[model samples]
Target chain A: MEKEIKHLKYFKVECFKGLESVELNDIAQFNIVLGDNNVGKTSVLEALLFDEHPFTLLRRFYSMMSFKGLSSNEAKDYYNSLEFFFSNEKDDKVITYTVSYNQLQKNEFQFSIVDTNGMTEENIDNLKNNTLVDLSQLPNTIVLIKLNGMTNFYTTDINLYRQKKSAEISYQPFIKSGLSYDNDLVQFFSSTVNNDLKLRKEFISNLHFLSDEIAEITIDSTTVPNNPILMVLFNNNKRPIPLFMMGNGTIRMVRLILEIMMCKDNRLMIDEIDDGLHFSKMKKAWGIVLEVAKKYNTQLFITTHNSECLKMFKEVLEDERFEKIQKDVMVYNLFKNSENKVLNVDYSFKEFENAIENNIEIRG
Target chain B: MPIKIQLFVEGKSDKKFISDYLDHLGLNDVEIIPLKGKGEVKNIPAPRLEKNQLQGVKNGVIIDADKDKEESLKELKKYANFNLFDEIFFFPNDRDPGALEVVLENCMSSTKKQDFEHCWFQYESCLDNFPQGFRGPFAKSKVYAYLESVSPVLHSKFQGIDKVDFKDSSNWDLNVSYLDPLKMFLTKL
Candidate 1:
């Protein structure tokens, strides 16, 4: 059975003094946030994962203290609470659930329960064993429950994935496509064939065929001799360059197409997917992203300002290719109100287009 | 000092047509400047004098009737309310500014008895083409087009023909564009 975040019935968000009691209700899975500049769209995203505080997860994705709306005191309290908020369960050896916020008062923060039976110790161990493990083997489902006293507020179960044993040799878990490893991946290919030459040629040829409208790409095995590497020439006399030398959009396309061909479980989160691309290019980008998402069972969360991004995504939804991806995708338009308060309005394609055409500020 | 008649136009084609037309009219003291879009309203030079100070500007202002003519007129009234200039003229066309090319095509076809193949081709043939990005057109084309089709009364008022030394050369060197009539209307303001 496919899993999806059906609806965010109600959400009570708090981070800074100004944004202490914002609420959102009746959220569709694919909701859009629309608003003018300086609205707290990014804040809401952070509020969900972190307890309105900066964490290692936040640091890895974006800079700390980059966003405003919180006082220095509140920011400190949010960081301090992470230690007291969650700890390992003693007897059951599972993570205990608790919800804490400024409004709840000291030690008065209450939480509801949600079971995580499918996430067994074995699966957790398998997930966190390798330093470079594929995120696919990680938890796919998140359970949320509403707190008893806090109306319209919910908390999700948090479980840490830890490895039980440690091998002396640093072994990277390489999920193969049953094809020969590219020379770059050959070191990690245990007992796999050393036929990198054959696979590399096929890969470049396949990429060339994919972009038939563009010139054919040639694979020169002698120069770099790396696995998953393609040297493509644009003109007859010019020096050939690696495919990576192309812009980030092209590189992203290359990686995504290769992953789709491989058909592996890879969840991709593309930040600013519209970077270095025009409106016309974005349609094809959306198509490629969806194609990869379907072929690899990958979940894609792309943040973009390009209207074409939404247009193409809506096309994917209407066509119903991986019809579920549409249900899985979300769009949020963040806007600042006349009061300088930030609000987010979630909308589908029709609502968004209508609002845009009519000059209606739809952010709530 | 020569009086600078700064004419802000909507686009390159309009600018070119207006500039050439004005130059032909012997308005050597006038200078035309094109503001490409409504967005450039902010950058249009404000009065060099302080608010509630100095005398009003002697220069004239002309703006297109714009897409939303009623709203544009209201805005122009507010714009002129500052008393920055003596006059502001709005020409509300039935269609977009690009329709000038079509208007020219229809006029030329009626007078010459031959349909012009392409607006771009005819425009290129008539006007001095600039580099890739320089925007301006043969200023006199719009007036020439208007004069060819408009009634004689409107023509005489808008296009006051000058005395000719030679036969057809009079019309050739003459200010054939409608800008003189536009300026004539502005001179009263």
Candidate 2:
């Protein structure tokens, strides 16, 4: 199997947010993060951005900080610009992070927060578009540099983000959304499903879990084929309804399906992975997720506060097919120390199920 | 986190009896997990707590020492696995010339015990050739008969057979010599 891009084998963060010196060892292909509220489950996902510049990471981090909605324009305030760092103030604040190839077999570069010396509207525009903007060129913008890759997202000009979006790469992210506008998600969703048979088939099969009446998925007649607005066709209805007309559970499922099918050699991170699905269908949803994710070789990281979700995931992974790759799946239960920082406990598959069956309250 | 203990008992009756005994001994943080039946306990693995969760969490099972103690112990041993169960105890003390009801019978007052014997003799005399080799110790039937002789009306209140107090409320007490080993062993855990 030829991996198109280097996968993250291990990660460690020091002096970043409430997470101080957090380290995850032997990370799996399919990983899950569980903890109580505000334990930084989403923050940890944001930290694993794998971006070339800090600004893109910053934009993502800021959007995430606002809980998936741009409820605030703190990104525009220079005084609060650096508040994203630990302690919400950046006076000589520097966050150091390291990524390694599988157990740190090969060391990855160090990216630091540097002074913003130069400022230009175009540079900011390019960063927003996830295009290559040289950190060296923008001596003014917060940037990340790879020690061995030689060129940063700014220099080598590789907008893997944009390239992924265009090439249907899976690095799709479903950050928190609280009645917020998501231009990228909205844009990607509307344009990608037109005349896509494979996508429709996958959507139909996955949608059946939510409603047996869903017979078809297609673009709304109001929208032309070229500029498609996706819709769902129920078995009993003569006319199809716009996909958004359905509940959040339907939307979450379709979004997840699209990401799984589109991403190859990429990854996905979802917050509250089990928000709307019933507990009975949770195991089925995971089966589809595992099937499609593996079909595309997509690495997945999701966070859940639901125990039934974890229990079902363990049920699906119990198949002998997942036995060898069971090592590729990991479960982490996050806890807060007395100092009010996050820490985690990793359980092997067997032990995890054991804990759940015994009702030990691992989630809290 | 403080240590947690899980007990896989045969059924609710075993749980009720053992829990009451544990309560009398002043133990805390012990959870009774009823497997619903002895067969389930035999089929299911003992709850092996993770050492990483804390330093001293422990788990085990409590089951009946049904007639034929040797065979019962043999089957119970099948549920035992290394590192899964730190302890295993048979009801009415590890010794099994009797069951939990035997312990209940022992805890009765001297006068009640004599009356219980008389009721047992009368009930046996009324039987036309009881089941072959039925020497004695029909624990359950004898207790019910003795209670009925004590009060036919209050016998109607014998809701849970496992919780029947052989003596009136003021004289209630478990026979320590009959219960000490199991109690001491549990408290130590």
Candidate 3:
């Protein structure tokens, strides 16, 4: 028999954003992170977006900045946005992220910003103009990505990197807080869910929590030339309406379900998972997420501050219907120690249930 | 202002008893947290202590010395980080192999104590010759019988140990020496 390969068995972040250093061991398939405001709950998810390929890793990093409303089309604004990923307190200006799939395989990603003033003019011109520049000679405010013993660099100016071809490999999906429906949803629906009958049925069934009237979902590229809109067809004779016309909760759930389905055999991270979700629908939403993620073999890392969301997660995991996956779920409470270092306090299913039932303050 | 001291107890009854005791000591800063039962005391306190320590709050736990006194204390220390807590005291004077009921029994007034002794003696004598042997941890029953003997109508109306006021001098003497150890622990907090 072959040994099972967990997606991420252990994770560690050092000097990334607000996290001075943090480590999570024995990572479960479904992890729920809880913390007070500004405790680096989202940073943990961002740190896990690293990849062995530098281009894919950089694309994910740019996407995260864009999601946080920090991405900019202007050169200076983009340079400023990149600074948020590094720590201000450290002089070295290097951020390290490491993850292990199992005991035998460990991957580390190191990112550092360099200044071009110390380098020769030829090296600076090459870094600014060329697609593949020498790693030894870097330009001003450029980020050098080191992964799997390979080195690649990207200029801080957004216009420079925009000319480079996009990475062909797909990275893990990170569904950020307050996420709105975008073109990615339409692309995923058409490329993955639309072609698969089983996935299409599962998607529609999950949407019944929003409205049982949703009979089918289709793409409406003809309604608007050169642009595609997701339309929901109702069970009644009423005409189809655009998916965006629905409530924020409905749109958010669709994006979440689509990403989970698309990221099969990969990890998916969602920050503030209960942003647009109502307390009443939380349990059902969790049920769909857990069931779908398990079916697709997608590991999950979700963060939330809402106590009601935590309660719902507890209730869903405790249900006998989810008993087989109960042991795979874990809750982690992130808090800062006296020295301002972020620490993780993880609880297994039994421990988390105990804390919730007894009203213990596990969300620090 | 945030509470500076937190004390974890076993259940609501224990919460009520400890709250009243803290009031008698005039300690206003201590917050009492009641868990489901002894099982939670072993599991819940460490995480809570870690959280509280982050906020610079002092933590302590007072659990019942059920079955064995030293073993209970040892188990608590084994599960929870010992150095994180300011104090860890067991109920019933922190020395005996008993529970809160033992402390309540000792706090009974002289007249009620005599009545409790007579009542417990008769009850034990009645069960002595029974076919089903009464393996006894009858301290709780003794305390209930003592309360009923004091005021049967009032005791009948009470639902749980928490409802019985320990401050009433006619039923209980709050200044009893058995509670001195617990009082000293609170004063330190």
Candidate 4:
């Protein structure tokens, strides 16, 4: 049988975050990354988002730093946050993330920090004395992005942090843990599924595992004028309740399903996919995810620390309903080697099934 | 400090047998893992050994020689090429070409051996009267018959071969020479 082609066939990361060096080959459509905490499961997801235009790359870089509670509107603080993105083991201060869409095409992005020693003593003293220094008048630290035989540089300016630009390249939605349900959900729903009845039906049917009472979902701007809140109409004909009022698991599942629905023919990366979900819901959750991913041809990359989640993944893949795409799954186990370098061990579908069935420890 | 040791066996029967033997040797810190079958001995240990590599666990495997010692060893070495196992020992003293049943047969008492031989001769004669020959595994059949002869009530009450306590003196002599290689392997571990 011929193998199914995936959007990302290979990936490699050198000097990014806590990962010293790591490479993942033969990437599958549905990949699960397992490792100990701080072993760089989230780093791999961050690297996948690196293959973007320079503007979007800068936005993503800031977004990642903000995720770590390092957000700042000042130019100096933004420059300080760049120190946390590189690996501590290397002294040269260069980071590279590479990805291959197919065997013949490869894209590599290299990032390096440039020092600005041209600031005069008087200018530095003025910046220190002032509450908000004008970025146009000061020498700033610049980040150079080189990709596809092109180079672009962005300075640590307030405007770079304030500009919100959508990605011009392929869209890959990354759903992290504790994601807030905000206007993005409203815009995504209203633009994509609101006018299409088939998609809305599919979304509601997939969410039935969370609760059958979720009869319909909509964005209500009248409840809080100018603030559109996602509301759910239950089957009991009661008043619509805001999505934030629902349980954490329900909100997480809703967000996940929405992304999966919007992520057709693209890739989606989810961290700690079983974060707020109960063990009993894993099987149905996996079933819905696999069905939607297969239907839309969207590749999936998910991470989990729960063994029950792995077990349910194996069970759902082995299910007779998913026999066709059973061979499209892979599990990557990451662990630090004897030399303290991060390494990954890939397991094919059969090998993963064997390990799970025989009670072997592959989660590291 | 003593090194932590982990031993992998083929099935529940092998696990029970080795667990008792290790206990007899007074080595209790060793962990015995029973895999699904012989094929899994090649498939299951790489990831686990890598996971525990930092802990400095001495990993090893105890498997049956089956029909050929060299063939089994060659196949295992191919799969276990990760340099994980500290040692790999085959059953029936590692040099022989048989399974746990061979060791059990060797441990039978000399006095009962004569009685069992006579019963075996009579059983073979009874089977010869039927033109179709007996087609079961010879060593396993002999071990089961020997267990039944030792105590039919105990044999009937136990569910499987793995549940039979090898600690009973009447079942087998644990001090036999056929088990010295396994004992030495455990001792070294």
Candidate 5:
């Protein structure tokens, strides 16, 4: 019997000049996508989330590639040829992406067509509205986010208790020296300003495991309370360290934590699983994520460029500590064909172990 | 897999004292659960814990501070929610546990004598006639050192001790540490 997948949707994309075809097939309860760079990992997701048609994509591509000097007719010809090469239609591409239930019973169930062109602001608004339409009532809804080109802004805006206000804003000078007061009012604001209050409250109240973990974090309001810190103490320290103080891996973990905590829905999509993380901390971090996912019934979809993370992930899932969380975990190795089309194979534990034994590069 | 024994010490002194004492007794399996004040043990509500809450399932042995054994036990009982646990123990010192160490000098074995002396409070350090360190079972040598290093304070008012014993009249205004006294319950296992 196949595992029960929470989300039954799948996505596919194709183009001429770039990649011929890219597809993310077999939507599992929780799945990981592993591939090399330019293997159309991000492209598959982008096409799924934002693809409209070849011309529409070509317009964006033309702007990005700075083909401004060319006439519109030339550009249109280039796009037309590109679409024809990839698609059966002259102006269209035969991009094939499939959404399938992991379980055998629902082999051919198809939901509403979610066009990839919805990447535009107007489309995003529509998509978000549509996504939220029955979200308040849906039992097993999936929410996907492809985190690419997401820059982390290191803002040092001070929330001072008694600083004089200036309407004129200077970005450089203002950013360097920021200050915040430590008083009762500031304390109240700092503690209560979480973005998702209802979800946060429920998570706090319902999960019994959090109390033990919360006991470990001590925030010192005096030194830097309002700074919004995420500190990863390799050793014990009194002062609350901010996330900026730690390495990228630590920051990534913090990002993962914040996202997981704020996600109102059960499904999450993390594009790259091992970006900026230390090899040593990957297993432990995966352990934490798996634990939280199980406790909250979260379904995770992740892409990875780290073979070590994948290997460790497999090892941990096999461990007894991960038994409860491993029920529906799936792994897929996505690769591009000679024709520059992407395809995937359901990665088995034995195959992963063999890959490790044979010294295959697990990370993309 | 091991029978977890959680020992709630009144203060750092009690923790070190009891830890060393038990180590001497070859009871290595015990865990000293520190309490912030004499009142913290009162908060653990009694109930059959669901599986999720069972992550912290070590047995609780609350060691509360008191000037008199009877009064302190009564106060401690009021806080120990019935389902919290039943193995709470109380200690009302004639003076601070540091001073109490001096009182128990003959009781501790010769091998453990050094450990006891390191934790005792001197009578000169009393806030009033009562040993000032004992005024807060929380402020003796070992306890003070543990807390100071972990969460330090700047220019503590109880540098030596308070001169006024508000326990008598309560005529003058009383200023206690207004911070969450239950913060001690947040200690990592």
Candidate 6:
């Protein structure tokens, strides 16, 4: 089944991390969110992933916390920090989010703690009652989790519903800076390419922007179809290197480029688009980014702390070739204030250029 | 992003001084952007001021009322909408066309200003070997001479005045009488 949803034009999230009832609007095809550290930039991406089963994403969230060097107990406490995800209401039993494709269609989901103290029949019943969208037909998901502090125990459950009809959405891809380190890229690339030789070629060619030394990138077909390893052939070295040994910048860029190419008419969310690439390659990389995004009509939501990235992105997106379609690219600065409320400062392309010229510290 | 106001200044010194003054006036969230010179202000990026982009952020530009006040204002008007700002000030409050240095000289103690004048007159009286109308800018030369008279080390060691903070209210005995217009405008902002 496919989704009719192509562009996630808007999002409103409440009671998720530090973002308290934050609303992001006028979302362009290619969006850049700029802000200081710990200002809810990542939370925005997490909110978009609300359609995914929360239990499946628990490891993703747990890894996000544990990688920061939290101990076992600290990681558990952090995971159970309902107050962190709780919106400002005195008793925030529910956290809700919605990602809209347009005026008529959207995916909305919510998680409520009917048994934060302990998992009860009432708790499971609450999730069943509050299932906002028909999951199977509407491309929606809901996860219910409970933590019992007295016994230091926790339980997570995932539910998939039978929808009356299945809705068709193009595709939606989400990437964080840590994707490569999570050992998920190899299988991701393998399955994304599937058995299509053309997709395999397209993926490899895009990665050539990172290094011309690679002759080609191919998946090992002899391995299991669902979990195939990637191999790269360099021009000078006859010995082809497996993609598993690929380092930071290479894997990150590969995943990003492949997703953009394969997703076609989908939406792509990248947490930090400027990571691992050299400062010198910023302009060229952005040029490629603009070319492909415009070509495939992929809506992008990318975040960055580097002003140069923003500047280069503007330079490429407004080039004569793409200038006619420049309205699709927008820059926004997200800020979280003391009350945990989030606000965004929207910058038109012209304003973004002026802000860069004026050296305004938009990121800070 | 909630920057209540933004001040575009001529260069580093103006940026530093005005930033401190804004702090002193308790408009701490305001941003002061240092520009290369008067030319950039005249160009001013030219974005529509009435647009939503700058709706809440009041924008102001401070330029030297250099040589031709009318010409300076005219060029600025080409880019900025004067009505959009709460206040926009020119340096040297009572000026026959001058820059930031002239404004700082106005901030000096009255007795020091007189001494600076006396020193300038002494130097002028001895310049009999120069051509007619050969004198340099009085405002700039006088301020440098004042610094020299007060402390020879400051005159010799100071590479330039662009980074000095003349608007630091606590340490600077700025002639508030001379500063009234700028001070009033800043306080309102």
lDDT for each residue of candidate 6 in A1-364, tens digit (9 for 90 to 100): 1234477777787777667676777788878878779888877776655444444334434434443454244423543653455655637556666667675665565565443445466744454455443332211222343222111112332112211121122123567665663335555554556456776776667667678788877666565565567778899988777776877666666777777775577677788888877777788878777667766677788888887787787777667876876677677677654454566667777667666766655775
lDDT of 6 by residue, B57-157 (tens): 66777888887677777766765445554556788663457787777776666666676678677777667447675564465777776654454255458
Worst 10 residues of 5 chain A by lDDT: A168-177
Q: Answer with 2 or 5, whichever has the higher TM-score.
A: 2
Runs of candidate 1 with Cα error greater than 4 angstroms are A1-37, A43-241, A255-268, A311-330, A356-364, B1-189
Residues A237-339 of candidate 4: C-alpha lDDT, one tens digit per residue: 6888999888777788888888876777767899999988889988988887888778777888999999999999999888899877878987889887657
DockQ of 1: 0.02
Number of clashes in model 2?
7
User: In lDDT terms, how accurate is model 6?
Assistant: 0.63
The 10-residue segment of model 4 chain A with minimum total lDDT is A163-172
Pick the winner on lDDT between candidates 4 and 5.
4
Candidate 5 has a TM-score of: 0.38
Q: A39-101, model 1: which lDDT tens digit per residue?
A: 554344433332211122223112222223221333333333332222222222112122233
Q: Which candidate would rank higher by lDDT, 1 or 3? A: 3
Candidate 1 docking classification: incorrect
Candidate 5 docking band: incorrect
Please write out the lDDT profile of model 1 over residues B1-189, one tens digit for every residue.
Answer: 334444444555555544554555456655455555544433343422111122122445556654554566567656532355544555423323423343233323232323323453576555555445444554445545434433245535543322111123312322224334454643443
Clashing pairs in 2: A68-A176, A116-A140, A117-A140, A118-A140, A133-A154, A134-A154, A170-A263
Q: Per-residue lDDT for A73 in model 4?
A: 84
- The digit string of per-residue lDDT tens for model 5 on A200-293 reads 4543433323223331222343556555332322234554454355456644554455444433234556666677667888887787667766
The DockQ value obtained for model 3 is 0.36
Candidate order by DockQ, decreasing, is 3, 4, 6, 2, 1, 5
For candidate 3, the chain B TM-score comes to: 0.85
Fnat of every candidate, listed in order: 0.00, 0.00, 0.33, 0.30, 0.00, 0.12
Model 4: which docking level applies?
acceptable
Q: Which one wins on TM-score?
A: 3
Best of the candidates, lDDT: 3
